[model samples]
Target chain A: MATLKDVAKLAGLTTSTVSRVINNRGYISENTRKKVDDAMKDLNYHPNEAARSLRMKSTNTIGLIVPHVSHPYFAEMISNLEARAYEKGYKILLCNSQCIHEREEEYIRMCINHKVAGIILCSGSVALDVFDGVDVPVITIERFLDNRTASIECDNKQGGALAAEKLIECGCKHLLHVGNIGTLSMPADMRTEGFREVCERKKIPFVEIYTEDTQYYRMEYDEMLENVLQKYPETDGMFVNSDVIAAQTLQTCRKFHISVPDQLKIIGFDDTNIAQLTTPQLTTIHQPVKEMAEIAINLLNDSVAGKLVAKRTVLPVNLIERETT
Target chain B: MATLKDVAKLAGLTTSTVSRVINNRGYISENTRKKVDDAMKDLNYHPNEAARSLRMKSTNTIGLIVPHVSHPYFAEMISNLEARAYEKGYKILLCNSQCIHEREEEYIRMCINHKVAGIILCSGSVALDVFDGVDVPVITIERFLDNRTASIECDNKQGGALAAEKLIECGCKHLLHVGNIGTLSMPADMRTEGFREVCERKKIPFVEIYTEDTQYYRMEYDEMLENVLQKYPETDGMFVNSDVIAAQTLQTCRKFHISVPDQLKIIGFDDTNIAQLTTPQLTTIHQPVKEMAEIAINLLNDSVAGKLVAKRTVLPVNLIERETT
Candidate 1:
């Protein structure tokens, strides 16, 4: 590893002058800057970001905590977020909590200790009081922790309504909404609310089934979905809360010899890659993942700069009609 | 935001004693350590990792660069790697290079500047000279660069041979092997070699098709796959290199009305989530991703400790029988 002294000696300059050139702390002539740059390049010198961050009391890094990276939705979100953050001269400290409370807490504390510029929380099981005494700017996606933390989420209510309306338009008589357990009271609960309201207003019979917390964590809904199908043989259409579940529903329908789009029209949420990979393809609600990621990064940056940001930001969702409907 | 001095004041101890307790440096009485810990909790104190890292000249972080995080194969790898690294008390600095040389270069420089303990490279398109002068231990997965850099990969050739043997046993008369462009010479190229050797030894007719670099990065192989099917309509069995491409192949087969496992048996590689999400569930080769990740981290740690580690580590792969075959 080459040090500042080596570069300075090679460039025939003082160590302080070289430091100023590297840090851009003071103005230097173009000729002197080029000389220092060439010298550093020749020596393969990289300035220590740890020392620089300590002096600046901050780092060009953001801590992003998600429940699981292997999930299609979070995987897509992380990809978009990493690209957007890199575009703005930032890096991501990736943390996969796997929905463990203690792990999430440890990651949060680690971010604070490292003096990260901000944190983006996309984990589902984080408690509301987790950010009570945190000093760094915290922004969450698809999760509303509390009134103090800024949040960005797609319009879950509108998404649910869109799915219901699409199913009804397809002549679905009895509707089913598969969702997360209602006890969490998450922003996603709005999805069920929207689905039920649309069904009731149109005088259509509907039922909502909540999945256990374990199902969400394991990303498996096959057994539960099979039971749902067996219990509701009269169900003409179904709206699944996530594409992962919707994909499984497609498989389950096959097992029961129920044809999709013919016997039971299906619509999924979060138009991730899994939607298109299914056999008949899936009609889904697009969550505006790329746009939401961009907005989340911008909001974190603004909050870190001491600017007052909106408490809650909701973007619109649209229905994508595919072969399933 | 509470400083060491604040914790010391609250604990009724000198700053030196509090610092010793926080760093776990020189021995301190259990009673004094308890008082310091309680005060830190009360004051909500978080030690500055940046300052500590500066003093130690290394950070408890590993840089992980992958071509695309959204791809199911990489997504699962990342999830496993993060969990393993967390157990070892290290964080991951994630970089989605998207196969751009400049972005990969920038990430490598950033990791070096931050003084990460090691780097795990899972990217497909990185140049061999990228790590020419990198100071940290560089480990490659599924891609072999130079002898100087350590590499870890599953037994890809054996995976390819297994896929071929299974398709033969399933009563396939003709075969096809789909793979990446051969110019890159990645460790995954052995898949093609193994497939071809099996077909030749069995005296079975087979064809090999290579996807363009653009197709690999975009994760879309519909058009090319459509061409392959049309060109080789007699092909009764196929082995795709990755589960992502295999999923797309399944959809393409549907478009052409080709029945899977009846008229044409199919086997995919990597056994990622996409394999299960697809209808008929792909029968494919399973890479030991978790084991590979654990070994990669261990090798990096040992190399960083100045221990002589193996230049190349290869783990075994197994065939998972699903519905497709």
Candidate 2:
């Protein structure tokens, strides 16, 4: 309810004088600044943001887009990015696309229209063409676009290799790498490349499982993996692409009476909260999501300041051995 | 790299004309709009946000403060709030306080300085007196403040009562309500009242196991509950205050070889994603988080437009049945 006019009138000064003090624009006496501050507290004056944003071209905010915040991947990314952005005195506009491409574009349009300092993309299949020739700086995590657009991704290839190596060390013979590794779905490439390279070097027979092009969350891959295990009971080792996949595998393994780390030395990616929730706490490869998110926010901030950011940034991954293998 | 001057020069107009085009203000011809749009696209223009914010007073964005985005309870709230806010063409500024009072104050100050349209407090433990004379409209969820301020919360009494009735129906002789009830740490008075009321009516003996004042999360509470179970082995039916708590109860029960429904039927609250993640699934109370968020935004929007809003908005809660009960 308080207005700048109220504070100015109470301070017995011109509104422009009050404005200068609040915005710290023009020179004003220290005495007048103190008077204005006291009057503002008394009047509870908050400079109208809607009005002020019309003059200041930058809101000191960034727009963040993700597929699902409840999902471990996005949740961790959001917390990490939020802490980092706050440290830089910047706020984050969180957008949950719910894994829809159109929703992702909707947020992008809003970010452009609002003139955010930077836009960070953490999820959704955002096409590079959409950002082609766009004016604002765009940064992607786990997804990459045109050359100007920067990217921060986990070394999924390394994660894949780690899981494979762990499974083999656990004395697994027959292995089944159940996941979709294609061009459209971004990180699958690094993971599949790593998994395949390790399998080839080990001279062990491996089977591949692919799903519908749209199954980005691995929900659709659950049933397919169930069938794979049923069809190949001799498969002693399973390298799951995600923690959620490994969780579902535990449930299915329970149904089939397949013991984990005994009959199935399963290794999952993304050490999400669910990784620990599963029955045989999933042996997972931990993606440095928090570190990556912090780095992404910094990179976006630097780019907004017109600093050169690396075209590609890769985060590390670790194998957290738990109950399952 | 394009500036307002460049756009104006290319459009054969003044700098104010380009500013008006970007702001969507004043009377401008459709032809002029088209020409400005074309010029902006051709020149790859991005109007600086700070300059615009200086005039607008409000940024057409809302600030959301939560404890942690990685937790299921807050993550669900974030996802729900983002979905609803997006539909209303409002963006969100995320602030994770980690349940620290100082961090919450920092977020509040940041929101005020940035001049966001309004703020939504998803996690609150701050003294209501601290925000007594603030200028902006703040809506708190699951936390009550001064009578003058607005709050959107689930009918906690009903949720507690619902949990009690379900647990009683499961045929347990003696039961205990697990959570920090009415303590400043959690301040979950509704659950406490609901369980006490139901027990009094049924003449069934009940005990309260309040965890020491500490942070609330699934993993942390799981360890606490494990200790509580050892102290009160007679506690057969549990009216746990959260789904994450219930998930841990199930895991610890497994560790102790206490088969649920057979030995200890459990009922949790807040039907978060963790409900599905838990084995035997958790039968919990459903809080309409998305609708609550939508109302928070609408109430703030009305306040900005100089309209009255309800001081307290209470939505209905439901009992979702699963294996736990």
Candidate 3:
């Protein structure tokens, strides 16, 4: 029964301040926020979005579909995206598609029907057909969906090249490149392309290995690493597609009694938390996760507002040299 | 301009199968799902949630509020929760409060306003006052809000006791327990309490250290570890609150020229991905994140359906020993 005006009057603040607290649009000091919240509570003001939807014809929510948040790269990216969305008066409806095409399609359908302002797909499954004829504003991360869709991604090609260059500079004669098998057709495959280019140009003998995509399950990484090690026993350096894979490689190297840098120099991509957690902290290609996330949200907001945005935004990546190299 | 019946007929499947594909409620074979999807696409049949919501008078969505998903534990938990929710025809609206009380409170208010059928709070901050007089069914993880809100948590006290016992059994005379400074009053603080109890009962000389909650910001962990090592140079064993912290401890120990297991036995809680990624893989208390997430969702659903649910659900924890111990 209580309105925003009453709550603002009670809290001695403007209605915009009270609206900001409800929408989480902008910064409000803790003291001001708490006072407004207390006043709203005291007045039993329940400003439910369901009611607002009927009048406004929209909800302040964005749908975010990721392969899986348990993966460190996506997890950190989702964290950044959620923070930026909240600052811009939007919340994320999270769907972990687990890289399944059917599941990703289902989430896209759900988003289209849920009246969310827009959708952000952090998947690389090349399944843009699901969004066909859907009117919702769609923004993608790390994958190029279609001509109509806006996307933000770190330069995977540049990242891969940086890794290859670093390993070669470290005098790695016999190199190995490990990547997720599922990401072969996605933009991330550029990492492998870049790595291969450097290896070919430098006249370095290198082997390319594609491992299964899953990361967290026990012993899978060990098994993959074992197969790679047995097949390429002469490998003196490796460039992994992601930090998680690089960490597993470091662990496997330890098991095989291979000293890093001295025997097997390693470089990883997407410098997520795992890069630092590893013993000889990974020298990785630092994907601009926060920057990409912010840009994705901004593009999504622009699209939702019926404004034209760039078709593709490529952020920069840098090589962070740490103990691993 | 197409319908479920039309798609089902074209796909040569029952309408229920097509409905399952649309709602994603039950298990459908991948082949059947694809056939149905192809039929729907060919017919331009877009089954969205808005129409379903208007008919059912409820949306199949849950609002999940966590401090941040970049933290390994929360990321894994969100992954599990999303999987379970999708299996039951629900999606997650994610809010990362970033451990700010005002931000978290704002999220709760927004959830109350939104059409999400339920809300799950994965925050440790005890600011339940924000939920006062809210109508939505609420469930919390790892923090007890009130009698009205059902909560699920791994036994932090038992986890702490296990950590202490393991350290002592490993011949650690001088021990240390490190935890987040912000969780001092929450249920997680029970870990510290249990560790202290074991130390007091065994008469082991132990020191307690609390660090700021922010992580992944460069040099904070280093500074915290520097201060801890400077103050307690004789510490032979440690029980860190989380695997992330344990990894930092291990890295700091390496810098300080301390060998793990031999000179400094260490154990961490949350047995998250970081537990295995580290070089000397951490021995940690395993919190059944998936099981807890499933239970939390079930309770929220029960409450949403106007059924009474238990006030508290405490899951079990296990001690997983590895190289660190």
Q: Report the Cα RMSD per candidate.
A: 3.8, 5.8, 3.7
lDDT of 3 by residue, B1-325 (tens): 7888999999999998888777665577889978997897799786656556545545778989887788888889999999888877688989887777777887777776666788898875645566676677888898768755688888999999999999999999999888756543577889988888898999998888876656532324777887898789899999988888889888899888999988999998898888888989999999999999999888987887789898999998999999999
Candidate 2 wrong stretches, greater than 4 Å: A1-57, A129-137, A180-183, A211-234, A301-309, B1-57, B129-137, B185-187, B212-214, B217-219, B301-308
TM-score of each: 0.91, 0.82, 0.90
Model 1 misplaced regions, further than 4 Å: A1-40, A125-129, B1-39, B125-129
Off by over 4 Å in 3: A3-42, A55-57, A182-184, A214-219, B1-57, B182-184, B215-219
Pitting candidate 1 against candidate 2, the one with the higher TM-score is: 1
Q: lDDT tens string, model 1, B1-325?
A: 7889999999999999998876655578889988997897788888888999888758889999998899999999999999999976689999998987778876887898889989999876566565667778899999877755589999999998999999999989889989876556688999988988888999998998887767887888899999999999999999999988889889999999999978888999998977888888999999999899999999887887789999999999999999889
Best by TM-score: 1
Please identify which of the two predictions, 2 or 3, would achieve the higher lDDT against the true structure.
3
Task: Tell me chain A's TM-score in each of the predictions.
Answer: 0.89, 0.84, 0.89
Best-fitting candidate, scored by DockQ:
1
Clashes of 1: 0
DockQ of 2: 0.41
lDDT ranking of the models: 1, 3, 2
Q: By lDDT, is 1 or 2 better?
A: 1
DockQ of each: 0.79, 0.41, 0.63
Candidate 3 lDDT over residue span A185-226, tens digit each: 677878888888888898998888776656432225778787
